[model samples]
Target: MADISFAGQVAIVTGAGNGLGRDYALELARRGAKVVVNDLGGSGSGVGASATAAAAVVDEIRAAGGEAVANTSSVASREGGASVVNSALEAWGRVDILISNAGFLRNGRFEDLTDEQIDPILDVHLKAAFYVGQPAYRAMRANGYGRMLFTGSASAMFGHAWQTNYAAGKGAMLGLSNVIALEGSAYGIQSNVLLPTANSRLAAEMDQGFMEIPAFAQALQNADFSTSDGRVVPEFNTPLALYLVSKDCTATHGVYSSNSGRYARVRICAAEGWVAPRGATPPSIEDIASHFDQISELGDFSEPMTVYDEFTAVAKAARKQGVYP
Candidate 1:
């Protein structure tokens, strides 16, 4: 296959100072994108901000002969979101891709999760995607081309012990991206979600001791974990992210999990189960108890393409059972 290049495209990567975001920004720039490297430079818990983190990434991009500009704006507020996009417009004239990868986590069990922990996590991971995408979306609509990617998480899909706030925030991103994909299709804009697992500061914060885990250590011992034998360190989970935001990627409203150089698509589907008989007045407790297994079965399931699909299924079932004339 031919090489995929961004060429004249402009990309905005949030939290681009380091880790996965930095990897994404550099890769996009190397592939010919003029990038906006946005980083609030705050601690992992989302307190305070600095310009150094963003500036350093931008400096590195330029030194490597790639174009980049720094923006130190929080993704948790409307003003901050607008300011980041404004920096992109001022520096590059237009935004063709938005990689909403900015996020922070405060881990706690469900019972211990506070409003303080819940609010910022949602503000940054979910709401900020909306704030930044809105303006960039408008620009894309006018130009008739755009690609958007939201950073989702495996914790949201598979559950995590001490990550109620984090999981809730990431789960909301799936809904956000799905809606954008549906709405943006007419305007030539596409949106998708990515669940990435990588060794970043956030991962380090999750458990510093995870680095020394036996499984990871074993892989390192075999040299299987090395992407570049001691010199050019590889951030393996980034390719899926870059592909999702590339112009050639026509896929929309999809979810994917990526890690350790492997990628897989994730999907949400409903189970097909029991259908009530004609004139059934909300099956009794005894009746439901008897059919519970059948009611929960997944065999012969139907995928609902829209909200109306559920209504249509109900209507059809009613007619089939002679419940409706």
Candidate 2:
């Protein structure tokens, strides 16, 4: 394969002060992208802000002979989102890619989770993507070229005991990305979700039991082993992110899991499921229970291309049963 480059392109990477976001900003800059490194420099719970975190990344990129600018704006609000993208516009004249990687964690069991805990997670993880992506997406649509990658998480897909709020927040990103993928395709804008397994501050704060699951635990430990020093560095996940948001990447409407040099696509598909004959009167509870096995069979699965596709399937089945007038 040829070398991938972002020459002449402009990108905005949120939460770039440190960890995965920092790595992504640096790599994009290294590949000739003019990057806007946006970070609020807050703790893992999304409190406080500072310029140091973003400025340091900007300095690192410049020192390495790459182009970058720092934007110390929170992505959780509409104004902050606009300001971040505005910074990119002022510096680069246009925006080509948006990597929404800003996030934080406030872990709590489902029962103990409060509205305060839930609201911030939703604001930062879910709503922030909307805020930032909206303006950038509009620009991309106008220019007829754009790439968007929203950071999701395995905790959302697979579930985590103490991260109910966080999982819900990340799950919203998946839905948001899917809609963007569908709507943006006509305009050359591709949107996808990233379920990254990096050793960021959020990972460090996770309950040990949450980390002990055999499948994920092994990956986490492997990342730990590869670090030269004892520090848990999130740079391990940058390469895949860089590729996903690059000009050469046209793959969209997809989800990917990246960590420890392992990358794979994740999909959301529904089973075809059993269908009752139309006009057959609603089935009894007993009848549904009896046909549960047929309804649950994975072999009957089909990937619906759109919301209408699902409805069309039902209509087709009804017509097939001679029930449509």
Candidate 3:
């Protein structure tokens, strides 16, 4: 295959002021994409703003001989999201890729969460995806080709103390991406979410001791993080992020993960559930309890690519057990 190139494509990368988002914007720019570097320039906890951060990235890109523009907009608001994408359209005339990587950390225990603590998390992470992603999606559909990369978190899939709000917001992006993938399938537009485990500004600010766990701590201690310009930059997942949104990658309706250079696909699947005999009345509550183990078993689970595919898998499972023809 020929070398992957963004050549004439335009990309909008949110939260490009620093860390992972900055790396994504810079790399995309290096690969020939005309980039819109959007950063809220807020505090790590999701407060405050400045336009300088975004402009700094644009400067770096320009200094390296790449085309880029700065956009200082809050992804948490309707107008802000639209403005971010509009920056690219106004400058480049078309939008081909969107990297929704803007977000902030607000960690609070489950019981401690209240309207004040959770709203910002929901606004910036969940609602913000809808706000900005929709505009870009429309443009991509019109052009009949596009790729999107949303940021997700492993904490949501598993569990992380003091991060209830953050995790909830992150988890919600999967469903959003799934729908976009289904609808955009026919238009040559692909949407996928990334669950990256990296030492970005947000991840570095986490104080829950989760990283102190031997598995994570030892890895970081021993790992030789590949650097850029003499700095130990461990956004090693950036390369995978590039491939995921590239024209060469046709992946959609999928949640992929990368960390410390390790990569994998994350999925929600259904087990081959226990079935009652054909023509029998619905099983009793006691029957369900008796077969709980079989019903919940993951040993033979199947991963469905779309909602309709899940139904097909269910029907096949039923037929195998004589519950369907």
Best by lDDT: 3
Error of 2 at 244 (Å): 1.6
Question: How many residue pairs of model 3 clash at the backbone?
Answer: 0
Q: Candidate 1: which pairs clash?
A: none
lDDT for position 1 in model 1: 82
Q: Give the whole-model CA lDDT for all candidates, comma-separated.
A: 0.83, 0.85, 0.86
Candidate 3 wrong stretches, greater than 4 Å: 209-234
Residue pairs in candidate 3 whose N, alpha carbon or C atoms collide under 3 angstroms? none
- How does candidate 3 fare on TM-score? 0.90
Alpha-carbon RMSD, each predicted model:
4.8, 3.9, 3.7
TM-score of each candidate structure, all chains considered together: 0.87, 0.89, 0.90
For 279-323, candidate 1 gives per-residue lDDT tens digits of 757777888888799778776555665677877776765665476
Worst 10 residues of 1 by lDDT: 225-234
* Best-matching candidate per TM-score: 3
Candidate 2 per-residue lDDT, tens place, 206-271, comes to 666556457656666665455344333566567778788887788888889875566899877766
